[model samples]
Target: MTGKIVWAAWHPRHGFEIPHFYDGAVAFADIDDAVRLVRTLNADDKTNNRNGWRAVKTILVRAP
Candidate 1:
Protein backbone atom coordinates (compact mmCIF):
# COMPACT_ATOMS: atom_id res chain seq x y z
CA MET A 1 0.00 0.00 0.00
CA THR A 2 1.07 3.57 -0.53
CA GLY A 3 0.17 4.24 3.11
CA LYS A 4 -1.58 7.39 1.99
CA ILE A 5 -5.33 7.23 1.79
CA VAL A 6 -6.32 8.73 -1.53
CA TRP A 7 -8.92 8.77 -4.29
CA ALA A 8 -10.74 5.67 -5.51
CA ALA A 9 -11.65 4.45 -8.98
CA TRP A 10 -14.43 2.09 -9.88
CA HIS A 11 -17.07 1.54 -12.56
CA PRO A 12 -20.33 1.91 -10.74
CA ARG A 13 -22.21 2.96 -13.88
CA HIS A 14 -20.71 -0.03 -15.65
CA GLY A 15 -21.82 -2.29 -12.76
CA PHE A 16 -18.46 -3.21 -11.33
CA GLU A 17 -18.97 -4.86 -7.96
CA ILE A 18 -15.49 -4.16 -6.71
CA PRO A 19 -12.28 -2.78 -8.08
CA HIS A 20 -10.72 -5.17 -10.53
CA PHE A 21 -7.23 -5.24 -12.14
CA TYR A 22 -5.74 -2.48 -10.00
CA ASP A 23 -4.17 -2.96 -6.55
CA GLY A 24 -7.40 -2.11 -4.74
CA ALA A 25 -10.49 0.07 -5.12
CA VAL A 26 -8.12 3.02 -5.00
CA ALA A 27 -5.96 5.18 -7.17
CA PHE A 28 -2.84 3.39 -8.36
CA ALA A 29 -0.11 3.12 -5.79
CA ASP A 30 2.37 4.11 -8.40
CA ILE A 31 2.13 6.24 -11.51
CA ASP A 32 3.89 3.60 -13.60
CA ASP A 33 1.37 0.91 -12.74
CA ALA A 34 -1.54 3.15 -13.63
CA VAL A 35 0.00 4.05 -16.95
CA ARG A 36 0.71 0.41 -17.68
CA LEU A 37 -2.88 -0.57 -17.02
CA VAL A 38 -4.12 2.19 -19.29
CA ARG A 39 -1.94 0.98 -22.11
CA THR A 40 -2.86 -2.65 -21.61
CA LEU A 41 -6.56 -1.85 -21.52
CA ASN A 42 -6.30 0.20 -24.67
CA ALA A 43 -4.43 -2.59 -26.40
CA ASP A 44 -7.02 -5.10 -25.31
CA ASP A 45 -9.88 -3.01 -26.66
CA LYS A 46 -10.94 -3.09 -30.29
CA THR A 47 -11.64 0.02 -32.35
CA ASN A 48 -15.06 1.57 -31.74
CA ASN A 49 -15.67 -1.21 -29.27
CA ARG A 50 -14.80 0.76 -26.13
CA ASN A 51 -15.77 -1.74 -23.44
CA GLY A 52 -16.49 -4.56 -25.85
CA TRP A 53 -15.78 -8.26 -25.69
CA ARG A 54 -12.30 -9.18 -24.49
CA ALA A 55 -11.77 -5.59 -23.44
CA VAL A 56 -11.48 -4.57 -19.82
CA LYS A 57 -12.99 -1.13 -19.97
CA THR A 58 -12.11 1.17 -17.08
CA ILE A 59 -12.55 4.85 -17.52
CA LEU A 60 -10.91 7.89 -15.95
CA VAL A 61 -13.57 10.42 -15.11
CA ARG A 62 -13.56 14.10 -14.33
CA ALA A 63 -16.19 15.89 -12.30
CA PRO A 64 -19.00 17.19 -14.48
Candidate 2:
Protein backbone atom coordinates (compact mmCIF):
# COMPACT_ATOMS: atom_id res chain seq x y z
CA MET A 1 0.00 0.00 0.00
CA THR A 2 1.19 3.49 -0.76
CA GLY A 3 1.38 5.92 2.11
CA LYS A 4 0.21 9.51 1.94
CA ILE A 5 1.01 12.74 3.79
CA VAL A 6 -1.54 15.07 5.36
CA TRP A 7 -1.66 18.43 7.12
CA ALA A 8 -4.68 19.59 9.09
CA ALA A 9 -3.21 22.69 10.66
CA TRP A 10 -4.67 25.73 8.94
CA HIS A 11 -3.78 28.40 11.41
CA PRO A 12 -1.44 31.21 10.45
CA ARG A 13 0.80 29.96 13.24
CA HIS A 14 1.65 27.11 10.86
CA GLY A 15 3.63 29.56 8.73
CA PHE A 16 5.47 28.32 5.63
CA GLU A 17 5.14 24.72 6.72
CA ILE A 18 1.44 24.72 5.92
CA PRO A 19 2.07 23.75 2.32
CA HIS A 20 4.36 20.92 3.38
CA PHE A 21 1.61 19.46 5.51
CA TYR A 22 -0.69 19.27 2.53
CA ASP A 23 2.07 18.06 0.25
CA GLY A 24 2.80 15.11 2.48
CA ALA A 25 -0.76 13.87 2.41
CA VAL A 26 -1.31 11.01 -0.01
CA ALA A 27 2.44 10.66 -0.44
CA PHE A 28 3.06 8.45 2.56
CA ALA A 29 2.58 4.69 2.57
CA ASP A 30 0.90 4.52 5.97
CA ILE A 31 -0.04 6.47 9.07
CA ASP A 32 3.31 5.70 10.64
CA ASP A 33 5.21 7.20 7.79
CA ALA A 34 2.89 10.13 7.65
CA VAL A 35 3.26 10.66 11.37
CA ARG A 36 7.00 10.44 11.06
CA LEU A 37 7.04 13.06 8.35
CA VAL A 38 4.76 15.26 10.40
CA ARG A 39 7.00 14.96 13.41
CA THR A 40 10.06 15.79 11.37
CA LEU A 41 8.43 18.77 9.78
CA ASN A 42 7.00 20.03 13.06
CA ALA A 43 10.44 19.86 14.61
CA ASP A 44 11.46 22.82 12.53
CA ASP A 45 11.80 25.99 14.63
CA LYS A 46 10.75 28.25 11.79
CA THR A 47 7.24 26.82 11.57
CA ASN A 48 4.60 25.23 13.77
CA ASN A 49 3.99 21.58 12.97
CA ARG A 50 1.53 18.87 13.98
CA ASN A 51 1.01 15.12 13.62
CA GLY A 52 -2.13 15.60 11.63
CA TRP A 53 -4.45 18.09 9.99
CA ARG A 54 -8.21 18.71 9.95
CA ALA A 55 -8.32 18.82 6.17
CA VAL A 56 -6.73 15.40 5.83
CA LYS A 57 -7.40 14.23 2.30
CA THR A 58 -5.72 12.47 -0.59
CA ILE A 59 -3.49 14.58 -2.81
CA LEU A 60 -4.09 14.87 -6.52
CA VAL A 61 -2.13 12.53 -8.82
CA ARG A 62 -1.97 12.33 -12.59
CA ALA A 63 -0.99 9.63 -15.00
CA PRO A 64 2.16 10.03 -17.02
- In terms of TM-score, the best-performing candidate is 2
Mind giving the per-residue lDDT tens digits that candidate 1 earns over 1-64? 1245322322324332233454434355455564454455445543222342122334345545
Best by lDDT: 2
RMSD of each: 9.1, 6.9
lDDT string for model 2 (1-64, tens) is: 4443433333344532456445422344455665555555556534343433323335434545
Worst 10 residues of 2 by lDDT: 48-57
Residue 34 in model 2: shift from native, Å? 0.8
